[model samples]
Target: MTSFQFTKMHGLGNNYIYVNQMKEQLPEEELSEIAIRVSSVYTGIGSDGMILICPHCCTCEDAHFQQ
Candidate 1:
């Protein structure tokens, strides 16, 4: 079993889950499963959805950042 941590936020009654990619590393192939697991109200954190925030290392506006 593995444990994950997230920051929670809400606006106008809508919930949000913030996952800091800069400090936390999650396997890209399993993001969908992780998202579903975290969104579960019974077995998980119970949020509307997950937002993966990444760090910007390049100046290209259209550049994709990955680790």
Candidate 2:
């Protein structure tokens, strides 16, 4: 089994699972599947959704560009 670290955060009753993409890499194709599993109350971590914490640098090709 694959193992990674995550953090759970909530605000005004809404909650989400956070994964640090800068520290760990996840398969891009499986992102949707992973989200569904982790968001399941009976089979997984149970959250409204998953959030990926990406690095903010030009070197990171997948990183979002900010002005």
Candidate 3:
């Protein structure tokens, strides 16, 4: 079986699933279905939404300048 590493978090009382994109590649076509399936209250993992964790490509200097 295939496995994907993820994290789970919640805001207020609403729960969500977080996927680290640096490690998992979810195809564009599967995005909508992935969200729907994961968020389904009755059929799937049951979340209010899914959150993606991705790296920030810019340098620290750029971040400081943007601030």
Best by TM-score: 2
**Which model is ahead, 1 or 3, in terms of lDDT?**
1
Q: Which stretches of candidate 3 lie over 4 Å from their true place?
A: 1-3, 57-67
Q: Where does candidate 1 clash, by residue pair?
A: none
- Model 1 residue 45 distance off true place after TM-score fit, in angstroms: 1.6
TM-score order, best first, reads 2, 1, 3
- Could you arrange the candidates by lDDT from highest to lowest? 2, 1, 3
Winner by lDDT between candidate 3 and candidate 2? 2
Stretches of model 1 off by over 4 angstroms after superposition: 62-67
- State residue 64's C-alpha deviation in candidate 2, in Å: 7.1
- For model 2, the superposed segments whose C-alpha errors exceed 4 Å read 57-67
> In model 2, what is the error at residue 35, expressed in angstroms?
0.5
lDDT of 3 by residue, 1-67 (tens): 2246667788789898888887567775776777777778876679877776666777664321110
Model 2 per-residue lDDT tens digits across residues 1-67: 2467899999999999989989678887877788888889987979998888876767645744221
lDDT of 1 by residue, 19-55 (tens): 8889777887887788888778987878888888878
